[model samples]
Each structure stands twice: as structure tokens, then as C-alpha cells.
Target: MPELPEVEVVRAGLAPAVTGAVIVGVEVFEPRSLRRHDSASGHFADLLQSRGVLAAVRRGKFLWLPLDSGRALVVHLGMSGQVLLRSPGSDTDRHLRIRLQIEHPEHGELWVNFVDQRIFGSMAVDSMQPTRDGLTAGYSGLAGGATGADGLAGSGLGWSGLIPSQVAHIARDPLDPGFSAPLFLAALARKKTGIKRALLDQTLISGIGNIYADEALFEARVHYEQPADSLSPAKGRALLGAVRSILNRALAEGGTSFDAQYVNVNGQSGYFSHRLNTYGRQGLPCPRCGTLLVRQQFMNRSSHLCPRCQRLR
Candidate 1:
């Protein structure tokens, strides 16, 4: 699955071409790609046609485009979903799931193709609502909060800006400009889970998965099994900083692409995988302390760490 940096790379790549472009037509090559909409594929295509894509936005791992009709076209790139911007007559991939023909007076004709080897990625039309701050509905202001009747909390009345309803409970990522370190530290002190487990909790802090969790822990020199509540405020802040720094660096490198499935909008693979420290480098030397890296199974997944540096005490 693509993490925050990977998704952000895609969002940035698609924004320039898709924003301000009107969807002249939508072709659903695979009906399962629109399964989340729960409507017929034809109706799904009709809802998006002729609507302008205001901007390509992402919150954590969820991506959406706020359309002219005040609804968002939510895109979930399940496992192998790739959104590619191709030339009008470009050769289509065998796994192309959905394709949108867009037109821009400035940029001319283009096609946005959603290709997925696995059917995990889905597109849906969802209602947009305001953030809890009541200031604006930009991605920066959106933060995770209580789950409401519709599964996300809000003012329950007229909204100001707009965000997809499904993303309401997703906490702001560390990269978000509105992210608060003090607030996150307070939340971290309240969790009874392990530090790595707490980091993976989307409700606590969004955009972190197992790969980045290990990297951040390696940087913070904290063990995965350390109790979350036991972390001091300083340590919590350091962990958050490590996360931000790591994410920023990965974003610069176009995110870590270990296989062909994860790629940029142009179908180019990321080189950050070569820069990874401990995610997939078990039995390798730890860059910091020269200790042998080890892997352990936790939550039915693998966790890599330097036992000498990240000892659980």
C-alpha cells in the first residue's frame, strides 16, 4: 500500500494536469473500481462528466478531487492502483480500470487513467463538509476528530469549505501545516499501546504505516515494543520530528517504490527504497551504531530494527 509520501507524490504529480480541467467523459473499464459509489457504473460516469476538477488533494493515504458540483471524487489506491496522466493516443495498460477524458483550454487534451492490478483501489462520489475549525475547508485545516453519526464529526449544519466525509476521522499528518506538536504529544501520552502501534493508529496520527514506523523508530532510537504512554514528552516530540523529516526526505525522492506497482503519475518508480535504513534491511548493519539489524513479527507483519540501538527497556 502507498503511504503518505507516496500518495502525496501522486497528488502533486496529478494536480498540475488535472486541476481546472473539465472531465468531458469517464469510461469505467472495470466496474469494481466504482464499487464504493454503490451505483451503476454508467451513473457513476455521468456524475463526473463535465464537472471540473478543482484540485487534487490528499489527506494521509486518501486522495480526492473536489469537483465543481460540491462533491468530491474519492480515490482509494488499494494495493496496486496507479493514476496515470497519458497522452490522448497513448497505449493503455492491460490493468487500466478507469479512464477520464479531460479538457483544458490551456493544457489541451489529456487522459487520466486509473490502473490497478489488485481491485483494492476504488473511486466514489462522496458529500463534502467543513472542518471542525469553521475557518476553511482546505486540507491543511482538516484533522481527525470524533466519529459522528455519519462516521465523521462536523458542525452538523452549513459547511464552509469542503472535504470528503470519509476522511473526517483521519488525523492530520505531521507534514500538514496545521499539525500541532503539543496536541500530538498530549495524545501520545494517553495511549496504552506500544510506541510503534500508537504511531500506526490513524486516529492518533495519520499517514504512518509499518515501513515508516520502523524507520522513524530507528531514527528516534526507540524500540517498537516500548509502551506508548511511557514515552516522555521530549521523546514523543523527537519521534514526531523524525517522522516529519523522514516523510519530507521521502517526498523529495518521489517516495519509496520497491516494485513496479508504486509509481509516479508518469509511471516512473521511486528511488527512495535505496535510501531506506531498516524497513527491509534485516541482518544489515545499522547506519548509526553499526549494530546488526533484526526482524521480528508483530501484528502478523514484519518489523525491522537494530536490537542494540532500539532495545526495549
Candidate 2:
């Protein structure tokens, strides 16, 4: 599954092409892709046609495009989902789930194809909800789009910007400009769960998954199973810093891509996998202490760490 970096890459790639574009056509090649679509419980294609997109926003793993109709188009790239931008006469991508023919003011007509091999990914048209913080929902680019009669850039109600109702509950990612580190630290001090589990909790801090958890722990020199509440305030801060560092580096490297299923809008894979330190490098020597790195099963998944450096204590 794509995590923050991967999803952010897609979101950034889509911002320029998707924002300000009008959906002229909607074709659903696979009905399963619309499983999450509200459609007011009606026709998915009918509700979305001719809706002008304001901007693309992403909160955690959820990506949404606020529409002129006061709704949002949400996308969840499950396991092997890919959103590819292509020309009208281009070759159709395999496993294409949904395709949107959008006309951009500057870029002209283009196809936004949602391709998913596992069918776990989905597209939805959902209602909007104001964020509790009254801040812009998440990271967005090119806030350009069609204005309403009021001459507002988005839905007239878009003051502070609303997010998809489905995404309203998710916490902001570490990279979000609005993320409150002190609040997250306070919450971290309250968790009774392991650090990795706490990191994976979307309600606590969004956009982290198993892979980034291990990498952040490795950078912080903390064990994955280290108790969250047990961490000292300084250690908690360090861990959060490590989280930010790893995520930023991953984003810079275009995100970690270990297989063909994960790719950017142009179908190019990320190279961060080459820089992995602990995750998936079981039995490899630790870079710091030369101790053997190990992988252990936790929560039915695996965690890689250097036992010498990340001792549980």
C-alpha cells in the first residue's frame, strides 16, 4: 500500500493537471472502483459530469479534489492503484478502473485514468465537512479553479477549505503545514500502545505506515515495540523529528517503490527503496554498530531493526 510519500507524490503530480480542470466525461470501466462513491446513492457518472475541480488535497492516504458543486472527488489507492495522466488517443492502461476526461484551462483535454490491479482502491464523490481546526484541510497545489457567482476560488462555502466528509476524521500528516507537534507529543505521551502502533494510528498522526515506521524508528534509534507513553519528552520529540526527516527524504527521492505496482502519474517508480536502512533488510549488518539487523513479526507484519541500536531496554 502507498503511504504518505507515495500518495503525496501522486497528489502533487495531479494538482497541476487536475485542479481547475472540468470533468467533461466520466467512464467507469470497473464498477468495483466506485464502491466508496456516495453518488447520493444514485448514478456515479451523472453526479460528476461537468463538475469543475478547484484543487487537489491529500490528508494522509486519502486524496480529494474539491469540486465547484460543493462536493469532493475522493481517491484511495488501495494496494496496486495508479492514477495515470494520458492523452486522448494514448494506449489504454491495463486494469483501468475509472477514466475521467477533463479539460484544463491551460493544459487542454486529458485523461485521468484510475487503474487498480487489486480492486481495493476506490473513487468516490462525497460531501464536504469543515475541519475541526478550521484550517485548510491538507496539502494542496494550484488552488486555481472556476469561481462561483461570489467570485470565490472554490465552493462559496470553501472558507478555510473543507475536506471530504470521509477524510475529515483523519489527522494531518507530519509534513502538513498545520500539524501541531506539541499536540502530537502530548498525545504520544498518552498512548499505551507501542511506538510503531502509535505511529501507524491515523487518528494520532496520519500518513505513516509499516515501512516509514521502521525507517523512522531506525533513525531515532528506537525499537518498534518501544512503549509510546514510556518515551521521554525529548525522545518523543526526537522520534517525531525522525519521522519528519524520513518522510521528507522519501518525498525528495520520489517515495519508496519496490515493485511495478507503485508509480507516479507518469508510471515512474520511486527510488527511495535504495536508501532503506532497516525495513526489508533483515540479517543485514547495522550501519551504526555493525550489528546484524533483524526482522521480527509484530501485529501480523514484520519490523526490521538493529537490535544493538534499537534495544527495547
Candidate 3:
């Protein structure tokens, strides 16, 4: 599954390619990929035709496309969905689920294709009000834009800003500009869950998945089995800082690519996999303590860690 950084990279890649381009047509090859409107076949075509993309934004893992109309197109890439911008006469991949052709006067014609082999990706067009209400009502402020920072501060939530709805459900987002040592420590202090499971909770901290969580835990020299609430404030702060550093470095390197399926918009795999400390490096010598890195399954996900380095509390 593409996590926050990967999705952000995808959004950044598509911004220049599709921004301001007027949608000339919409084609859906896999009907199930369109989650909104049972009759998405005709509805998508009608809504997209002649509508210009006003802005492209990402809230959590979902890409938001605000069109000329009041409606917004929400896209979830799911497991292996990718948005590719192709030039005129370029061949569309057979795995394409949705394609939107944009008529750009100067750039010639551009095709934005959503390709997903797993069929887990989703596309939906709906009113912004319902979307906002649904996000706020159902998931608190953790889905996208949900709560006002001032109100949150007044309510003793201890933070501010346009809190993405996912934040309410997860902990802290290392990539978010508002991330702070104190905030991260507070979230960590409240959980008795395993460190790895705590890291995966979107309400605890946003953007981390199985891979990065293991990598971050390894980098911090913390065992995944450690109880989140048992970590000292200093250790929590250290772990928070490590998470930021690791993720920032990964983003700088275009995120870790596991296979050909996880390439970026340019069809390039992330270079960070080479710098991995423990992830997918079972039996390899640990960089810190020279112990063999170990892999174990917890909650149905593999966790890589160094036993000597990551001592249990």
C-alpha cells in the first residue's frame, strides 16, 4: 500500500501535469474503481467534461481535485494505484482503470491515467459539504479538514491548524508542519499498545505504515514490542525525532520502493531501499550492534528489528 509520503510524491508529480487543464473526456475501464454513484459510467463522464481542474490537493492518502463545479473528486489509490501523465500518441497501459484526457492549448493534449492492478483504488465525485461533514462526523478531525485549531486548543486537545481528519484517528504526522516533540510525546504517553502497533494507528500518528514503522523503530533503537505508554518522555522524544528524520530522508530519496509496482509518476523506483537499516534485511548484520537483524510477524504484518539494539522495556 502507498503511504503518505508516496501519495504526496504522486500528488506533487500530477500537480504540474494536470493543474489548470480542462477535462475533455473521462473513461472508466473498470467500473468498480469508481466508488461513488452506482451509475459512475455516465456520471463521471458528464461531471468531468468541460470542467477545469481548479486545484489538486492531498488530504492524508486521498487526492482531492476541486473542479470548476462545486463538486470535488476524491481519489484513493488503495494498494497499487498510480496516476501517470502520458503525452499525445502515448500508449495507455492495459491495466488502466480510469483515464482523463485534458485539452491544454500550449502543452498539446495530456492523458492522466489511473492504473491499478489490484482494483482497490477508488474514485468518487461529490459535494464538498457532505464530504466535510462525513469526515468530521464519522472520524472526528482525522480524515481531512475537520476541527478548528482554536477550538481544539480551547477543548484541551493541545494543538492547532487545519488538522487533517486522519490526525484525529492517528497520532502525529512527522511530515506535517505542526509536528512537535511535545505533541508526539503526549500521544505516546497515552497508549499501552505495542510500539509498532501504536505507530500504525493513524489516530496516534499519521503517514506511517508497516514498512516505515519498522524502519523508524529500528532507527530509534527501540523494540517494536515495547509498550507505548512505558517509554520515557526522553525516549518518546527521541523516537519522534527519529521518525521525522527517517521519513524526511526517505521523501528526499523518493520513498522506498519494494518492487516495480511502487514506482513514482516518472516510473522510477525509490532509492531509499538501499539505505534501509532493518526492513527486509532479516539475517543481515545490524548497523549499530552487529547483531543479525530479525523479522517477526505481529498483527499479521512483518516487523524487522535488531534484537541487541532494540531491547525490550
Candidate 4:
């Protein structure tokens, strides 16, 4: 599963070309790639053809392109999915499932290819809803978004402050400027579950997975099994700060790419995997304390940590 940093890289990559680009054609080589698409709403191809992309926005792991029609094309990159941008005559990407032929005023024609080896990823055309807070729906770098014909930074539609209806349930990610730390900390102080489980709760805090959760816990020196509400306010703040730091570092490094399945639009692998302090490093020596790290079966998955450094107490 692609986490925030990985998805953000894709979103940022798409923003430059897709903003204001008109969808000239939509090709679906694999219908399963649109499993999440609602047939009752409208035909996928028909709904998108000739529609202009407003902006590429994301909240948590969910990515969406707001169309001028006020509907959004929601994209979920389940495991083994990659969105690639390429020229018309370029070498075809393997496992290509869907391709959007878009024409931009200045950039001309380009292809946005949705490639997924496992077929778990999906694309859909969905309705939109106004955000409760009336804040911008998601992050588009719109504050510093792609420049347009008028030399403006963002689309008028981008400021609509509407999010895809299909993605309404996701909470804002830590990296989102609108994510409220005081509110999140207050909520964390009320959680009855384990800290790791709480972090994995998208409804609670979005964009965290087993990988980053482990890394953040290690950084905060907090045990995965520790209760969320058990942390004092200072400790909670410290943990949140650790998450931001780790995510920023991962973003700078282009996110963790364990395999070729995870790559940016240009198909380059992120090297953050090399900087991992914990996660998938079981039995390796913990960098901070020289203790042997361990992996424990957790919620049908696995958790990596330093038994000595990340003490449950």
C-alpha cells in the first residue's frame, strides 16, 4: 500500500500537467481498475471526456482530481499500483490498466497511465461535498500550486473547498496544513486502544501504516503496545512531532520504496528504505541502543521495534 509520501509524490507529479488539462480521451484496458466507480452515477468515460481537471488534491492516502463539473475522479492505489506520466510515443509501462489522454494549452498532449500489477488499485468518478470546516479539501501545493495561463497559482475550482464524497471519511493527515494538532492530541488522550492501532486508524489519524507507525514509535521511544490515552500531553505532542519529522524526511527522500512497485511518476525508486531505523529490520541491531530489534505478529500483520529502546512501560 502506498502511504502519504508516496501518494503525495504522485499527486504533486500530476498537478503540473493535469491542472487545467482537458480530458480528450479515457481508455480503460481493465475494468477491475474501476471497481470503486459507481455505475449509477454516470459512465466513467463519458463523465470524463472533455472535462477539465481543476486540481490534483489529496487527503490521507486518497487522491482525487476535481473536474470542472464539480465531480472528482477519485484514485486509490491499492497495493502494487503506480500512476505514471509519459509522452505519447514513450515506451509503454507494464501492467497498464487505464490511460487518460489529456491536452493542455501549453504542455500539449500527455498520457496519465494507471498501472497496477495486483489489480487492487482503483479509479472512480464520484460526487463532491463541502467540507465541514470550509477549509481547502486537501493538499495541492495550491498555496504554491502549478502555474497556469494567467500566471496564477491555483484553480478557482481548487478553492471550492469540496472533497470527493467517496473520501469523506478520511481524517486529515499530519502533513496537511489544516490538520489540527491540539484537536488530534486531545483525541489521542481519549483513545483506549494501543498506540500503534490508534495510529493505523484512518478515521482517527490518516496516512499512517505499519511502516511509518513503527518508525515513529521508535523515534518517540514509545512502545507500540502502549495505550494511546496513557501518554501525557507532553509525550503526545512529542509523538506527533516525531511523526511529522519522519514523514517530512520520507517525503524528501521520495518515500520508502521496498521494490519497483513504489515509484514516482518518472518511475524512479525512492531510497528512504535505506534510512529506515526500524521497520523490516528485524533481528538487526537497533541504531540507537545496540539492542537486537524484533518483529512481533500484530493484527494479522507485523510490527518491528527495538525490544530495549521501545519499552512497553
Global lDDT of each candidate? 0.82, 0.87, 0.71, 0.88
Ranked candidates, highest lDDT first: 4, 2, 1, 3
lDDT of 3 by residue, 1-313 (tens): 3777777777777767666679988898999998644453348778778987755666455666666675656677888888878875688786889988898666768888888989888777755432222222122123343345323334322121222232234343566544555766786798888888888777667777777888889888899999999998888888888887887888788877888777777777887889888989999999988899999988987889999999997
Error of 2 at 251 (Å): 0.7
TM-score of decoy 2: 0.93
Cα-based TM-score, every candidate: 0.90, 0.93, 0.82, 0.94
Error of 4 at 167 (Å): 0.9
Per-residue error for 221 in candidate 4, Å, reads: 0.9
Which has the greatest TM-score?
A: 4
Q: Candidate 4's residue-wise lDDT over 1-313, tens digit each? A: 3798899889888999999899999999999999999999889999999999988988889999989887999999987889999998777788999999999999999999999999988999999997777677788886533223223345443434778888888998999877999999999999989999999999888988888999999999999999998998998999999999988899999989998889998898888899899999998999999999999999999999999998987
Winner of 1 and 4 under lDDT: 4
Please give the clash total of every predicted structure, in order. Answer: 0, 0, 19, 0
**Which ten contiguous residues of candidate 2 have the minimum total lDDT?**
141-150
Candidate 1 per-residue C-alpha lDDT over 47-139 given as tens digits, one digit per residue, 9 for 90 to 100: 898998877777788888878787888888876889999999899887999999999879999999999898888888888877755433334
Decoy 3 TM-score against native: 0.82
Candidates in order: C-alpha RMSD to true structure? 5.2, 2.7, 6.4, 2.8
* Candidate 3 residue-pair clash tally: 19
